[model samples]
Target: MINYNNFIRALIIKNKDIVTAIVFMAIIAYVLPYYTVGGQGANAPSDGQSVGGGGAGGGGGGAGVTGVPIHVVQRTVFQRPYELLPCTQSVVELKKDLIPTTDFPSLVNETVSKFKVTVLNVYNTPDYKAMLLAEGDEKKVLQDPHFLPASATCGEMILELLPSLVPVTNIYDVANQVVSTYHVKVVDVYNMTDYKAIVILAEPDNAITKDSRFINYNQNNTLSSNYTGSGELDLSSGHIAAPAPVLKEETLPDSIKRTFTTEDLKGNAKSNFSKGVDADIAILDTGIDLNHPDLNVYRNVSFIPGGKTGDDDNGHGTHVAGIAAAKDNGKGVIGAAPGARLWSVKVCDKAGECKVSDMIKGIEYITQHADEIDVVNISVETPLSPALNRAISASVKAGVTYVVAAGNYGHDASTTSPASDPDVMTVSAIADSDGKCGGTGPALKAHNVTDDSFAHFSNFGPSVAIAAPGVDILSTYLKGGYAIDSGTSMAAPSVAGAAALIKAGDPNMSPEGVKKALLGTGSTPLTPCEGGPQGYFTGDPDQYKEPLLFRKLGAK
Candidate 1:
C-alpha cells in the first residue's frame, strides 16, 4: 500500500539504534578481559581469603577449583637499652611488672595486641636486664607509647632492626651484614642462646645513624660498641738474638726453678722426669714460634682468618708457651710443666690486638676439645662481657681448668673479664728479684730496683687467686732465642703450668678440686709489695696480696 523504498528506509533507521548498541556491547566484552573487576587488581584477594580472583584470566569462586594462597613474610627484630647497664642487673625484674605474668605468651600478647609487634626472642640474664628481638614496623612500634613504656619497670629501650628477607645463620653473617649494610665494623661477636650479639665500631665520617638497624633494634646494644676501656696482657720481654747456654747440672734454669717451678710448689723437679708428661694445656694468645728450639708445641691453630700463620711472629705467645711448657732440653729455659703437651691457639695478631670474637672462637675450640685438654690459659684482658664469662664458665664445667691473667691495669680485677670470672684462677704479678725461698724473702731487686714487691704495674684485687714471678722474667723468644719480659701475662702461665702439674699428679682430680688444691697449698702470709706505686690497691693491702703458688700433690 505504501512506497516500498520509503518503508524499507524507515525500518532500517529504526533498527540502526539497536544495531549501534550491539556493536558497543561487543567492544566492551573484548576489552573487559584486559582490566580488573569490582575495583580489585589482578593480584588482590577476593574476600581476604584467597588471592588472584575475579581478574582477566582469574578463576571464579568454586568449591572444586583451587586458588593461589596468600603469604605473609615474618621478620626478626631485637630490642634492648640504648646503653649497657652500668652494672649487671636482672632484666626479668626490670620488665616483670610490665606484663601480666612472666610466661612468654603473656609478654607476646602485650606487645602483639597493643602495638602489632611480634616477639621472636627474649634474651634474659640474671646479672643484667633482658634484651628482646621482635618483628614489626619499626616506625609504628617506636611511635606506639606502649612500645617503650613510661614506667620505670620498662627501663630504657633501644631498637635493633634486621632485614625481614635476610636469614642470619651465625655470628659471622651478622657481623658481615652489619659491616656491609651499616658501614660499621664488628669488633666482637657474643654467642647468645639463639643469636650472635655483635659489638660494632663505627667508621670515621660515617657515624651510626638513628635509622641504622643496630640502633633501631635496641639502644643498649649500642653502648657495648662505645666501651673503649680495656685491660692489658702485660709483656715486658725482649728478643735475644743468641740462644742461652744449656744448664749442665739443672733440669730448669735457676731463674724459673727458684720461683714458679720449684720443688716447694710440687713442680716436677729435674729428677721427677714425669714433668706434665700425660697432661695437655692450651694457650690462647699471640701465635707461637713452632720452629723455636725450646718449645714442644703439639698443635698450632689460628683463629684470625686471612691472617699470618699460627707460628709466633710477635714473640708474645712464644714467650708464654715457653713459660708454660718449654721442653727440658738443656739449651734453653724450662717450663713449669715441661713434659706436658702444648696447644698453641693464636687469637691475637703480631701487634697483640685480639678481637673479642676471635677470642670467643678460640674458646669454642677449646670447649670442643675439652676432653683432650686439661688446662687453658688466657693471658688477655677486656672489659666485662657476660658472653665471654659464660663461655669460660661452660668450659670450666666441662672439666677444664682456666688460668687467666689478673690484668696489668693495676686496677680492680673485678672490673675486667676472665679475671672477674669466678670459675677461673686469676693470677697477679709478683717480682721475685732475689729468687729467695722464704715467705719473708727480700723484695724483688731486678731491673735496677731495690724493692721487688708487686711489679709496679701489676693489677690487684679480691679477684686475684695467686701470685707468681712476672718481673724481668726470662723465657723463650723469637728466632730460637731467649729474652726477659714482665707482665701479668707471664704470671698467668705460671699458674697454668702449675695446673698441668696438678693434673699430671692426679688425672682424676676435678676442676674444682684442682682449684682448691692450688689455692689451699699456696704459700700465704707472704710479704706485701713495698716501695712501689701504692695507689693500685683499692682494698686492704693484705687482701690484694695473693698466696704464692706451691705444690701439694698427693697430699690430703
Candidate 2:
C-alpha cells in the first residue's frame, strides 16, 4: 500500500552497490601476494633480508643489498606401508547380532566376492569375529568396501600404518585432515602424546592425497626421533651408571632383603598368604629371558610379526619380570609376588622400540583373555594415545589391573601417559639404597639425607599413587643373569608385584579396591633428595611425594 514497488527497487540498487564493492575488494586481494611476518612460507625470504628494496639511505640511491633468488625445494610425500595383523587379518565386533556363527560367514563371503577381496581364515567369538584376509597386490585392504562385514555393527580392526618419511609437524591438525580427506580413520597417533611421533590405525585405506604436507610415509621408516628407551632409566647412561655385579647362585639379593623384609612381607611369603599363586600377571615390555633361573615365565608370546620369539634381547623386560615374580627357591633373588604366574607378552622389539599398534594388539589379547589374567605390569611409558587409552580402559573394565611407571624424567608424573591416565596406578621411585624403612609405624618422618629419599631421576606430581624401591635395584637380567638398575621402571613392577599379592589376598577385590588398599595404607612420606639434579625437587615435598608401598595388606 505504501509504495511497495519503489521500496523493492531501492533495495535492489543497494544490494548491487554492496556486491560491486565486495567484488572490487576481492579482486584487489586476489592480485596482491600474501606475506607472512618472520615465518616459513612461499613469499617469506629464507635468508635474513628485508622484503623491501634494501638500500641504506635515500630512495633508489647508492649501493643496495642485492636480493638473492630463493630456491624452494618441493617436499616429497611418501606412501606409508601398513602391517596387517597376523593369524587373523581383521577383527570386527558386532553390536546387535550376538550369533555371528550363522550370519557372519555368508556376509563375509558375499562381501569378499563382491569386492574381489581374498579370504584366508575366519575366527568368531560371541562378541566379535576375526577374518584373516589375503594382502592384496596394492596392499590397501582398507580401500575395499567389502573388507568390513556387512552384518557387523560398530567394531575395530587392527592395522599398523608406518610413520611417514617426512616429519608430521602438527599431529592434531594433520590427523584431523587425514580423517576428513582420506578413506581411512585414524584410531591412534603414537608418541603424539609424548615425543615419539608415529600413527596407529583400526582400519586404514592408504588413499592419502599426494600433495598432503603432513603424514610422513617412509619405506625404510626409522623413529621420528631417537628412542628415549621407555623411561628415563637407560642402563647405558645417566644417573645409575654402574655395571651390574655378577652374583653367584648362593648370594642373596639386597632388593629382596630391603623391600620385602623392610615392608614385613617376609611373613606373608613364609606363610604363603599372598604369593599370587593362581593369579596371572602379564609383563608388557621387551621380551623376557625364557630360561632365567629365578624367573617362572609361564608363556612367551611376541606381538611383533616376522620376529616370533619372546626372548629378552633387551634386558629391561627381564629385569621388570624378575622384580614382579621371580621364584622363591633358595637362589639369587626373590620377587614381590614370588608365586605369581608370569606371562611374557613382548610388545617392544630388540632395539627397545614399541609401536602403538603392537601395544594395542597385546592389550586386546589381554582383554580377550581377561578371564585368565588378574594383573598387568607395564614398565614402558609413552605420550598419551587415545586408542591405547581406550584399550587399557577396556582391559580395566574386563577386570585386569594395570600398574604403570611414572617415568624417570624427574619432573611431573602427571605429564606422562599410563601414569597420567587415572585408570592405572602410577608408581614413583624412592631411593632406598640402604633398604631401611623410613618413618615410624604410622607417622611420616621428616627429611633424612642419609636414609630413604626420593630418587633424583623419578618423576613426581599428583598422578603418582605410591613409591617403591627403584634406585640401584638388583633384579633378573638377560641371558640367564641378573643386573642392578634404577628407574621408575623398576618402581612400577614393585607396585605391580604388590598388586598381585593384594589380588591373591582377596580374589574378589576390584581394581579400584586394590588401588585403595595400596595407596591408603602407605605411610612412609618421601623426602626430597638434598643435592642431585637441578629442578628435581618440586617445591612442596609433602604435596608432590606419594606414600611408600607397604606390604601389610588388609590394614584398612
Q: How far out, in Å, is residue 14 in model 2?
A: 92
| lDDT of each residue in 115-190, candidate 2, tens digit only | 6766654544444444544533112344444334222111232222333522545655554555445433334454
- 13, model 1: CA deviation in Å? 99
Task: Point out the worst 10-residue segment of candidate 1 by lDDT.
Answer: 1-10
Residue pairs clashing, model 2: 164-216, 164-217, 165-216, 165-217, 165-218, 193-383, 194-383
List candidate 1 segments past 4 Å from native: 1-255, 259-269, 274-276, 438-452, 526-544, 552-556
Q: Candidate 1, 456: how far from true, in Å?
A: 2.0
- Full-model lDDT, candidate 1: 0.53
Q: Write the per-residue lDDT of candidate 1 for residues 448-511, one digit (tens) a residue.
A: 2232356544567888888777655666767776555556777888889879888887877888
Clashes of each: 33, 7
Report the alpha-carbon TM-score of model 1 versus the true structure: 0.51
